[model samples]
Target: MSNVLYEVRDGIAIITLNRPEKLNALSIELGHELAAAWERFQSGPERAAILTAAGDRAFSVGADLTDPPEIWPFAPGVGVHVDKPVVAAVNGLCVGGAFILVQFCDLCVMSETATFVYPEAKIGLTGGLITSLAARMPHKLAMEFMMVGEPMTAQRAYEAGLVNQITAPDALMDAAMDYATKLAGLAPMVLSTIKRHVAEVLPKGPSEKAGIARRDLQAVRESDDFREGTTAFREKRPPQFKGK
Candidate 1:
C-alpha cells in the first residue's frame, strides 16, 4: 500500500497518510508521494482537498526522526500551489513538522483528542517552517508553543484561533470533508483569486528581525546552546540557553 493515499469523493479529494503504525510519520518516500498527490489533486477533477490520516490515533506525528526527510521537509500540498482549499483533519498528535503543515492549510478540523506542538527544540532542530508562518497565529501563543515545547490541546488551539473547528474523533474526517465540499461548491475562480490575494499579502513572519535575535540564532545554532538544549531535553532537564 502507498504511504500516501489519494481518493476523490464527490468534488472533494481525500488525502490520507496511510502509515498508521508509525502515527503517519512523513518519510522521504511519503513526502515525495504526497507532493505528487497534491499535484494530481490540483489538476484533477477534485475541487478541494481534505488531508487526514489512516488511523484514529494521529493526523500525523510529524517527520520521522530516525530517518528524516530531505531539507525541504514534508509539507502537505506544499509547493503544489493549488488554488482550491486544503482542509486539515487532525485526529491526534500534530507535532513538529506536522504542526507547520496544518498552519499552511486553508482550514482545519481538529479532533478532541488532538494536540499540536512545535517541539523542535527538544531535537536539536529549529522551527524554521513554523517561524515562517508564525504571523498567522498570535505572537504570545506561538512563542509559548515554540519556546516551551509543550503540546497544546485541540481546545486550546481553537481558543487561540489556530484551529478552525474542534470535533469528536469519530466525526473529524466528516467535519473536514463537509467544509472542503462546501468550499468546493463555491465559484472556483473567485475562491482561487481570493486565496491568492491573502497568501501573497499576508504576513508570514517578522518583516525585520532585531539584530540581537539574528545574532543569537546564528550563535546558538553554531555554539553549544543548541546542542545543550537537545541534550537537556533527552536527559529530561531544563535547557539553559545562553544568549552567547
Candidate 2:
C-alpha cells in the first residue's frame, strides 16, 4: 500500500499520511512520497490543501529512527514551494519532526486527543528545523517545548497559537476541510501574494535554508544541460545547453 494518499475534492486537495500501523512515522519512503504529493498539489488545480493522517493513534510519531528520512524535502517553503494554503488536521501524538510539519502549515486544527512533542534534544539528535517554531510562536514557549522535550497538549498548543482550533477526533477532518474550502473560494492571487509576503518576512531555521539551497542544486544537477555539459567536455566540444 502507498504510504501517502492524494485526492482532490471541491477544489481542495486532501493529502493523507497512510501508515497507521506504524503510527504514521515519517520514514524515508514516506518523506519522498509526501514531498511529491505537495508538488502535485502545488501544480494542480486545487486552491487549497488539507493534510491529515489515517488512524487515531497519531498524526505521526516523527521519524523512523532506524531508517530516517531527509525530512527537509517535504517541509513547506523549504523544498516544497507551495503558495496555496495548507491546513494540518492533527490527531494524537504529533511528535518531533511531525510537529515541524504542522508548524509550517498555513492553518491547523487538532483533535482533543492530539498532543505535540519535540524530543530531539533529549534524543541527542536534531535537524534544527524546530528552531523555526520560535518564529511561528512565542520564543519562550518554543524553547520550553524543544528544550524540555515534553508533550504539549492540544489545549496548550491552541493557547500558544500553534493550532487554530480543537475539536473531537471525528471532527478534526471537518475542521480542516472547512478551512481548506473557505480558502479555496478566496481570491487565489490575493492568497498567494499574502503567503509569499509572509514567507519573505518569516525567519527560517538553518536546516530549512540549507534544504532550499540543496533543492536548487539538485535541480541543476539533474537537468539535461548538466549531462550535456559533462558529455561535451568528455568529447572535446562546446556544450549545447537548454535553460530548462
Best by TM-score: 2
**Where does candidate 2 have its weakest 10-residue lDDT segment?**
70-79
Model 1 clash pairs are: none
Best by lDDT: 2
Q: Write the per-residue lDDT of candidate 2 for residues 27-131, one digit (tens) a residue.
A: 999999999999999889999999999999899999999889877899877878899999999998999898889888999999999899999988899988888
**TM-score for each of the candidates:** 0.80, 0.96
- Model 1: which ten-residue window has the lowest total lDDT? 206-215
Q: Model 2 Cα displacement at 213 (Å)?
A: 0.8
Every candidate's lDDT:
0.78, 0.91
**Residue 193 lDDT, candidate 1, scale 0-100:** 91
